[model samples]
Structure formats: structure tokens, C-alpha cells
Target: MAPATVRRDPGTVKPRIRPSPAPPARVRCATKRAAVRIAYVFDHRLPSTGADTEQLVHMVAALGEAGADVELVLPRIPGRQVPSPDDLAAYYGVPPSFRVRALPGPFPTVRALEKPGFAAVGALARAVRTADLVYTRNLPTAVAVRLAGGPPVLFETYRPWPDQYPASRWLFRGLLRARGSFRMVLHSHYAMERFLRAGLPADRMLVAHNGWDPRKFEPRLSKHEARTRLGLPMDRPLVVYTGRITPKKGLLGVLDMARRLPHVTFLLVGSEGEGSVEREARSMPNVRVEGWTDLASLPPYLYAADVLLIPPTAAPLSKVGNTVLPIKTFPYMASGRAIFGPRSPDLAEILRHGDNAFLVEPDDWDAATAGLRSLLEDPETAERLGRRARADAEGGTWQARAQRVLDFAAPMIRTA
Candidate 1:
């Protein structure tokens, strides 16, 4: 019967609901770690053979191990099926952390087809756009990414482009002058200087030597045991070279040495598809060409050798002549075997003559023969040099090299 009337001060304008200042825009502390997504563009097919393939495998694995989300952007043959990541990992002897993506294009083996198809370029550009950082060894691929206006790129140079591919000199110069966030990684100081002369900024250049997986290269068995496993004669001194059997690699000199020193057994552990170098070497009685040893099995051959030879020719005009720091050098050092090679500026940086290795004058076959003779005759000297080399290699593993690269790229990644 009675309606209760509540009387309030009309002046109490009920705290005008101000939306609690939107909770300070949620000072959201990011719970998950920011993963650095790296797009490594390479101009090669997966599960390929050669030093470049080996380097890519190690670099990708190392980057992954360094906590980066790494993916390899590679070329795919027009009609062929792409290999799975596991297949690639198995082929390269690397961990499954290294992932691969294929962009449809002409196979790298066909040098006539220099540039990738338009579709491939678009795909690569998209990948580069999404990545936090881009790393590439192929200048053409980097050029495509630059043209696409993608993220900052790091170009890793292993050779003097001007010398090897005179045709690409103009492209390389353009790359140096292009307006963008770009950096250069040279495999040797010589490479750095070459690029600097070609107009790259000094501050943007980094010299990172090629690296090896120490675990794979470490001497795992005794010399006799390794020789026995590899089916080598117990009496002869074994001299070995492991690399592509190209004329530019000074394989002819190795053959000559084999002919001169008939007593020593020369083992060439590498593929020999280029021209007649393999066939010629096979003709020699003292030279044994064991083609394409798997990465896992290479250590035993290195362990079996009394001395390792890196005999690239001194021809300044050859592809590998003036500006190559051989990838095998690091593994050779880690094998704890005496290394003998020409006095390449690149090699000299890591190897001191008579200290960690024996370096003779380039193309001086006489000096090379003499040095090999000395190493063969003096076990004490060889052992000392080998020990020094192994000590040097202890710090230069692929994982360590990857960490160095990541540290170098951190600033660029953050800014990107």
C-alpha cells in the first residue's frame, strides 16, 4: 500500500563512469620471447653436393642453434618435386632444425639461366618481407630482395666477384650503391678489402671466416685404425685432399706430385665430374680417387692421412685462384693432421707457415713437393704442427661462428 521513496542529493552526479583509464593500455609484458625470423636466400638446390651446399647446411644449423628461427629459401627445378626438410637434413648431415623452402626457378646448374622466374622472385620477395632479417650468399637473390624493398639484408661473400664473374661486377657495384639497410659479410680480409674497393662502406663490413663442425671432424680413431677401416696399405704414407676435383683446385699438381713420389699413396676424396681431372687422376697408379665421401665418413679419411694437401693453383685468373678461403681448411685443422698448401692470403690468416701448417709459394710445385717431403720425413715436426692446428680449431666451430653472426646482426634485427 505504501511506496517507499528514496531521496538522494541530486548534486551526487554518480561518479561519471570514466572507463578506468582503459587499464593503462595493458602494460603487456610480452610473455613469449621474440624470435628473430631469418630468411636465408641461397641460389642452390637442396641435397646438392659441393662446398657451398655444405656451408649452407652448417650455417643454417648453426643459426638455428643460436636461437634464430631460420629458413632456407632455395631454388626448385621446374618439373621436379621438392625434397622434404628431413630428406635435406639427412643429405646434409645436419639437424632437422634447419628448414627449407623452394622457389620455382631454373636449376642452379644451368648457368645460362641467370635469374629466377618472375613467380619465384615474387615468392622470395614475400618471404623476405615477412622475415625479421635476410641473409644471402647469392648477389642476384639479394638484388631481387632489394628491388622488392624487403628487410635489411646481409650479403655473405666468399670470393672476389669481380674476378670470378666479371659480368656481375656492375651488379655488385649497384648493390653497394643501392639505398637500403645493407651489410656485407666477407669470408676473408681479402674479400672485405675487395668489396671495400668496390665501394662498400667500411663500417658495414664484417669478416667471418668459414667454419667447421668440430664434432664431425675431430680425430675419432687412431691413424692405423682409420687406415685399416678405409682399406689403405699399412706401409705407405698417405697424403689426402678432399674437395671438388677441378683444375682450378690444382688437381693437376697433385697428380704430378703423385707421379714424382711414387712411394707415397695419394688419396683424393671428393667428386670428380668436372672435365677430365678425375679421369686423368684415375689413370695415375699412385693416386686413388675416392669420389664424394659422405660428411659423416670424411673424418675417418682425414684421420687416416699423414698429411692433408690443399693445392689450389696460383692462376690469378682461375675461379678459385685469387680470393678463396677453402671451407675444408677449418676441418683440416680440426682433424689434427698436418696441412700443406699454397701461401694464399686467406689461408695465411688462419695458418702460419711451419706453425699450424706448411704454406709454400703459390704454383711452386717444387716447393710443395719439398714441403710434403719434409712433413713425411719429420714426424716430430708434423705432430707439432698438427697439435697447434687442432688447438686453433677448438674455438672456430660452426656453432661459435653462428653466434658471432647473430651478435653482429642483433642491432639490425632490433631496428628492423
Candidate 2:
């Protein structure tokens, strides 16, 4: 059945739709039947697998593992460079049960609405209508999912875009309410709290933590072997900051840390987006900038590193980038390396001082360097911390993560 026409609230930035109250946990399973149809709407465009895509891939893979028939709705971007045939195969070959469909788009944005992105709304709505449930991983797609008629829509909002645009907050909130009687999923407790403050019903929101793909990041070769492969010096301690070279990622702080510890080799393994901090780290002999790596090659980099540096930039929007810990943390932990992080509210959940990770003030080179030096100088303490980190990561694999999503969505999945 198509959703009833939702009434617009004059005050809200977005249109409004009210979802039905979710049934109790016990009733969800008994009443619901058939294999759950889980639709993942997201972007799989190249340049790199952004955090949203990475999270989607793992979630889709896990949903399939949980016996849910999953279909991945990818944006069919034109003019964008597609991956090589081998890479394309690897990227799309998530899990057997998961399928991919591209929504053609080059949507021009007018005000807040993406016109081309809206092209996806019709097709996705049709697809969601057939499925047991509609699941959207990114914000742009969430708009389409909300507009579409479906069994039930459950959106995983990464951040509060409506909050960013106060002008459209009401409109977005209305649209959120109009999500065809669906649930909204969040990645962190921080995210959940944000939605609650925005007037989203607490029961309608859920926190699905990040999960890692164990295959891509397992305990590969030892530090010596891995370093040898990367051509990094085996003698000096190596601290790595992996991910895209963006401002919020705190690549500048990485340079500061490298300067503080000349004896420590700072290895950055990832591509640099426009306006990168590469220039600063380029000339330093102790630093190596390895641009763009395939997923297969990442294990060696993680294994070779003595510590993982997660220095997110100090900014209000930094929460968008740093709050939910990256999937890389899974492999970093599995590799049994000491991990360091910038003190941020979002990261507070994943990291604990002197436990799983060493948290320090963002851009505080003195404290960051001190933490790095402690890990480098005290091998016993480093090993103990690494052991704990690895244990924590191994427990948070895609399998476990998928299960969490299934359990959370059980209420809607059964009904859908």
C-alpha cells in the first residue's frame, strides 16, 4: 500500500510524515514471515570508497550473512571514472546474496534538493515497495527513500543535515516524519542523541555501530615482513595515519607529530583529496606519502605500523567525520597495534585512555608525540594495548555488525 499523503508542517524545513509505532520485540518475529528483503541505497563511486560506501558495503555483506536477501542501490555516476574491470568485479562482488543496481544521476542541486538525485526516487520507491524493507545508508538517498512508497523504510542517517541547514530543518524533519512509517538508524550513541534533540522519537532511533571486514584486514605478515614489503625502514618505529587526506582527518596534525619524532617514520597510506596537507609532509625524510592503495594491499600497511594515528581535526563539523570510528580501526586493532586518537566526543565511545586507545587533545603535538613515544619506547605496554585493541576489533566484525542491524530491524523486517 502506498503511504498516505503527509501534511506539511509550516515551521519545519522539510515535509512531514509519521511512521507507525513499532510492535514489541516478541511480536515482531512471530508475526513476520518470509526472507527479509533488505535494500541498501548508497553511492559506490570511485576516487575512493568514502566512509558511507565503506559502511554500506560491510552492512550489506552482513545482512546477506544473516539470511536476508540484500540488494544494493548504487548511484550510476556519469563522467566519473569507473574502476578497472578487476577492481569493478572486486568492488561489486560484496557477497553472493547482495545485488547492485545503479540509479542514473548527475543531479544538479537547486537550493537543498538534488534534481538528478531525485531521479532515483521513483525507481528506488518502486524497488522498496517490493521489498520487505527499504534501507538507506546516506542522506541524499534518504530523501528519495522517504518519498518513495515501500513496505517500511528504515534509514541510517550518518549526520544531521537538517540541523546544518536550519532553514530547511523543518522541511527535512517533516520529510523524516513522512518516511512511510519507517525507522531511523544511527551509527553512534552520539548520533542517536542528535536525532532525539531534533524531536525524533527515541523508540524510532537505533545505534548501529561500525563493523569491519575481517578478510581485508586480518593479521597478515609480521611487522618486519610487512615493513619490508612497503620498503619502510625496519629499525625505526612506524606510526601510520591512513585514510583520505582531508582537512577534518587531521593530516596536518600528522605532520606535526612526524616533526616531533624524527626517529619515528610516519607512513600515510591513502589518496589526498583536493587541498591536501601533503606539501608539508612531502619533504620530510621520516614521512612517506603512499597515495591510493587497493584494499588487498592495506593489510601489509596495517601490519607494518606500530601504532594507528587517528588525529581528527578540531572543528564543529569534525563530528561528521570522526564520531563513528572507521572500519580501518578493526584491522588496525586486529593487527595488534597501539592506536592513538584525537579527543572527540564521537570517538569517546570507541576509545578509552590507557585501555583500547590513547586519546589526546586534537592538534596537541606535545601530548600526541608523548603518546607515540610511550608506545614506541615501552614495547611491553604497547603490546598489551595492541592485544586489547585487537580483541575489541575482532569482536566487531561485519558478521556481528550485520546481526545487530538484523536484530534492530527485526520489527520492520518481519512486517515488510
Candidate with top lDDT is: 1
- Residue 203 CA displacement from its true place in model 1, Å: 1.6
Each candidate's lDDT (Cα)?
Answer: 0.72, 0.63
Q: Model 2: residues >4 Å from true position, as ranges?
A: 1-33, 43-47, 78-89, 105-116, 123-125, 160-163, 166-180, 272-276, 316-324, 414-416
RMSD of 2: 11.9
Report the Cα lDDT for residue 251, model 2: 70
The digit string of per-residue lDDT tens for model 2 on 153-251 reads: 677766654455555456546755643456777777776676667676677677777766666554458889888877777888888877776656667
Candidate 2 accuracy as lDDT: 0.63
TM-score of each: 0.85, 0.81
| TM-score leader | 1
